[model samples]
Target: MNDQPLDNLDGDRDHATAGSGHDGEDHLRAPAPRVDGYAPLRSYAAIGDGRTVALIAEDGRIDWYPTPDLHSPPAFAAVLDEEDGGQVDLAPVDEYRMRRAYVVGTNVLVTTFVTATGTVRVTDSLNTGVAGRLPWSELGRRVEGVEGEVSMAWRVAPGTMFGERSPWVEHSPHGPVLRAGCVTVAVPTLGEMTTVAQEQDISGVFTTSPGSRHLVGLAATHDEPVHVPVPEDVDAGIDRTIANWRVWSREFHYDGPWGKAVQRSALALKLLIQSATGSVAAAATTSLPESWAGGKNWDYRYSWHRDTAHTVDALFGFGLREETHAAISWTLRTLRNPDMQVFYELDGSEPRPPRELDLPGWRGVGPVVDGNPAARQLQLGVYGDVMGVVRTYVDHGHLLDAETARTLAALADAACDAWRRPDSGMWELPELRHYTTSKLGCWQALRCAAHLAEEGHLPASPDRWAAEAERIRAWVERECWSPELQAYVMYPGSDSLDTSILLHAHSGFDRTERMSTTIDALRRELGHGPHLYRYTGMREEEGAFVACGFWGVAALAQVGRTEEARQWMDELLETANDVGIWTEMIDPGTGEFLGNLPQALSHLALIEAATALGSGLEGR
Candidate 1:
């Protein structure tokens, strides 16, 4: 599929609608159409089994999914390649308005399509493990008519290895078996739909009357011997999968404003977890350009030390101690090497190296790359990221073994020696700069080390750490701050403002008038009305980092600007799709989404911002 904007299509008007009530009619105007095939982003609900995840659009299309495993090749690649990309679509045959939600407290998704013919509901989920044991290994979809008879069609096209490799299918007495390298695909049907192999893909169609039901399942195998189950067994697998999600989601303790959004984010985080290794991926599918075709595409299938630590903190906040502990233990096991690379595969495999692919990128963005070169960059902040998670565990009264403490201390000592070197900051820019945020991260590490030592949680030289932290702080204040610009620069001696600096106040760097001035300066220079850019000119050069906008709201709330923070918070919330999902970036000019869709970082920032605003309201 070409990456041209969907609005450029001939029948694009079929999906147009006025924005909801937020600011005013003009504030909600849709952006201009593009010749590209990229559609206006839709709300997507994620479902997973702690191994692989599937993204089901509000319109009932499974647009993005990595099969067999989170890091495995994508089965539904339409999210990246619109036309040739594979997808599993189950929707009404007639034009239908849709409303969707998750089964309360579970990852099972329920999408209802209301058409002139009638209304039908579709439930989607991956068959999950039972009591920590792998199940029948299936992706199940159940469609039932809720009202009048509604005709529906379903299609399944499994793209091979990021759209480069195509699978071959042959029929047997049992059913169909698909082969692609080490992966295998099997489908069992409970409806009267013909399964036929079309040029490099397989598809089927089914319809139902009121009170009727249909079921379809896709199964795959890795190293183990494969088995194809009968279609009748699909119902049992669906029941067990739904039950598993329900029981697991019951562990959530969050019950605050934006509770639904929080739960969804938690589910997303859970979906990214690799059940076999307990490691969490940063995102599901990769090579979705951060800034369309501008060379900002990255692979997020690996686990980043920074992202995992933040995820642990977020999960801890929701009272998920078991999951938090599992992640921490995974970190300890995988990060045994003192010279930790930035990221690793879920099973603690080697760092993923950057490799170019033959397929086109999402929205016609070229250079569809796989793996990430950032994995090998010397980012000093990783020291802080690791230490931060350790400190959080110790502070929260979670047990940290003596060996873990000793390893942490040694890691901190390594940071002390490495902090002076130049490396890529959190943003992962290609060019290495003396990033102020990176230095601040090192400072934070030493400070956290000092705190842990003083609390008797670890054996460390507090005096040395304290002195080192102060030295870094002085260097930042003296070298990184631009008195002429009245704000801290992106790097030393550079006047460019980076949205990352907004993190200082949240990280407890400095909350005085100078910090406030810096925050306000970032708001003025980077703010695109309500949606702030990560840095100036990023929209054309790099994708607008949507997380930075939430960071702005959190920064304002942190500095006691409650009203303005709330206003911006409302604006950000309003930008979410009807079902409340956020992408990595939002187009400032058109309100169209850019970059990767359903980004985990963007949702995490939303949770933080919403929680901060909710707490402020309670305090008042």
Candidate 2:
């Protein structure tokens, strides 16, 4: 993905000593100081060009970066293995402090580092091409002296993905090519001890004076047709990349409160979109544990229709019609049968079964598993989610083709027949049960389909769909509600409270009394200060689900608890990383981020909540 802030950064590669001099080529490893432990997951900022992402730590180390595509194996896996695959470092040689932010409305990350001597600003971006997505991936780092002189060192260390393949300097017509395994990177050879390759390493040390501009960049290829970008073109590519993001940002129509946060969330969600296929991934990284002393880690690189629908819905709210159409069209192509698969590869195929790893996870949490098995599970919520996008698309003055109409009709019938059966809920539980949210999803699906049918856009029997919706509603009210608990329970014949039920209020299902009571019941049962766990007894199984917390706020605002929602939102905003990126969950007590980052679902939920509270959609 050449063009989008396909963002975010980090690495851990075996060190290679730089072989001095380039008699046509040099192999070198500049000594990289070891960084032992991970900085808090909350300390990383996500930056991308739209095709790939890299997570930059607060201290100026790029801790994690998946190359070429979000679905590709990571080129930088330091965030996964600190001692083995660590980071590409660029910082002061002495004790230093730093500040970071996105450049206005764009995804270009500018981190300013201040040492005892002076300040040097690092501008990091995954450079996009001038027009469409880039033909290749490029990471552009420009260090400009903002104040007095400061000594800085920069190194290119291949991460664990390239442990057996440190960057080797080779002669190319384009100057010097750095090839490591299936990945090839081209960088400018200009610095003290320049163009040295040893143990397949390329690095340079330089000092910055006031007004001095030092640019270093990497052009990488992932088994694609390679067009090694020239150093001069690489510099121009950075300018164009920043310009492209700003140009895209102009289409955003959100003028609500938290405008910057909303835009940033939009930008992050933008990076997760698969430009070639038009699918949106759940998060940038997989296997970043969702809990400390982990047990719930799962690959989030694949696209979940449930999550993508939320993305599409939120993007539509921002007046980003292009994104909405792309996600809808791509997701529609993957629904082979009426029952929605929980997840799939960006190419609309089912993901392979998950495999376990023995490596230590972030913060010593082990059992990192990759490739999600959720693709095989029955997450009935996806029926409503997919139709929800269709609902919004029609609301925006677009007409669905006959194929989509047929799909909606089939889905309505599927929901009718399937709502009575037990299936995995949104959390993808293993055991089949009559989960309230699962039934509620089918209810919403039928209700949405019935609306389309009533409007004469679909061929479904509106009367039957309405009857089924009522039937599902009655079933949930009768079996899911717990008078003893004073709330809608997690599943039939259970008294456990579920935070997901908070969405029913927003969905206009059990609004007012039961929903408000559900909100109160869940808050008392599952709440932990500013955050809420996903279900009844998850206090220790995983971290706080940030999206559920925001969903709760939206429910509160919808129930006329505006001040309470505002108070909660104010606290949640503080949990965002320095560059305003968020993860899947949070450590409520320590405020540390838990799980994969630039989490699209969490950000989408944030937009939904803020828009609801700020625009009075909740109290409507």
Candidate 3:
């Protein structure tokens, strides 16, 4: 647990992920997914028009980003310390052949390198606020050539972390400004401070031809007040942030059937929602390790109240109820500080503890960690993740004003006086007990606080939360229903077989016969087929848990087993990652992407298994 040592500066980019020569112990070994040029968390590819997000990589190297948001600190970490983290590279000076996408309904990325003297493309985006976030975060990247004659060579390095800060280069009045504390960054095609190879780089070297565009922007500004950036006004703010994400994905109203993989997992959970603090980051890169799983490296940027309560109930089923009521008013105003923290720090406080970062992870699988001990673990499945987002924000009619109905009646009387204590459940796991999804998350938070206090809007004591939600559904079917390991076990005496009980069959608490024979006993004890593992032995401890493979495809589409839930959600979206993003573990036979990248609970469990395979499951 290296707390802080990562050196490599005085000339940055001297390569070899520069977290070098560490003898003070723990240079972290056993890392296999990568180690040298760091790129393969599914070869990156993520841009954002929301508040902040960037990943890049198929060799065009942005690596990982964080500056004006997403809990801002990282100013790029080379996807976890490639020569002291922070890179902007931009491909082609020779051999190339990339191919990204996104620019359709926008989060604007585009890639396309194809060298041997032609096609450049590039694109990327972060610029926005024609109607949403943009106080100055513009990333822009243009580069277009589209045929013969290509020769790019950019660098823009920033790098810092475990060393705390670096990148300095002020010139302002709209030019090279790249400070690094209250982060100022601007990169107007970076035409100076060149060292490259000795590396203090903001390098240059351009040369296009057919059509030629080459405008590389960067722009940051955490404490805001430093605009002036005008590479033609940040390429017209990346064409008005790609027309504000294609008018929010053409008024996104999901037409079902993997409609372009559910609008690219709803624009990768709308770039993990950082809009000033609608705080949704459950993945935008952090320590990135789960492969060779050492400290199982984590950071996931922060803000998790159970992945923003299942991403505001899958963006309120794509009707997009204002980022699920601004991530349920930023998770009930950060649990009013009396505790229930399970993740925070998109400025809502509570992180500051998890340290361990002398740096190596993301390719070395060390203990890179940043800040998260599950915010002092007590994850009683966040009371069914805050009553499944207050029962989908009061069944979409929305009216729990009075301080969100006194914080959902003090979280349904504190989940009915703590449903049989012993927490750290929903995989926060620190050895507390009773975890059958923390006793069905306090029996689905007193059955959703007795349906939000019988719709009278939470004044709740509702018959002592309906008799402690029927004594937590009869104490999780008498101590977590193991019946000799037929199913439900990861806790009461532990025969362990969880994937968080495959979402208690979409929380009807067992849909026909012990969660349908515990989904074939969790696909024969933590399946590796459609990738499962979130409990029982944890597959030598990591990969395969991409939202428990969409909660076993929404528990086989709410039990009717809809054609094995559409062939296990079409083989789990064919292990997404060239664009339709999905990471937080995979690689059960090289599907690759392990731990963190666009993972907001694996795209909110693939939009709740494509909205339970397009609903109509009579009362489910």
TM-score of every model? Answer: 0.90, 0.91, 0.37
Better of 2 and 3 by lDDT: 2
Could you tell me which residue pairs clash in candidate 3? 17-83, 78-86, 585-595
Sort by lDDT, top down from the best: 2, 3, 1
Task: Name the better of 1 and 3 by TM-score.
Answer: 1
- Report, for every candidate in turn, its global Cα lDDT versus the true structure: 0.72, 0.76, 0.73
* lDDT tens readout by residue for model 3, 1-620: 10122222113111111111232223312222344777677767687756678877666778777877766778777777778877787777786656555655666776666666676676778788666777777787877776788888877778874568766776544445666667777677622223332233466777776776767787777776777576777876777777777777777786555556666677888888877778888888777777674777778788877788777777777787677887888888887788767787876788888778787766667878777777787877787787778788888898777877887788788788787788777777677777777878788878888877887888755788878888888887887888886788877777878877788788787788778788888888788888888877878877888888788878887878777777777777766655677778887887777877888787778778878876724334
Note the residue pairs that clash in candidate 1.
Answer: 1-83, 1-84, 3-37, 3-363, 3-364, 4-36, 4-37, 4-38, 5-36, 6-38
> By TM-score, is 2 or 3 better?
2
Residue 313 of model 3 has an lDDT of 74
Off by over 4 Å in 2: 1-35, 162-176, 189-195, 337-340, 617-620
Worst 10-residue lDDT window for candidate 3 reads 12-21
Query: What local lDDT score does residue 528 receive in model 2, on the 0 to 100 scale?
Result: 88
Candidate 1 residue-wise lDDT, 121-234, digit = tens: 677878765576364357888888777878887777766666567767766667667666577777777877666776455667766777888887788776566668666676
Residue-level lDDT of model 2, residues 110-214, one tens digit each, is 776777888777788888876767877788888888789888877777665624444455777766566666877676633333445445556677888877777
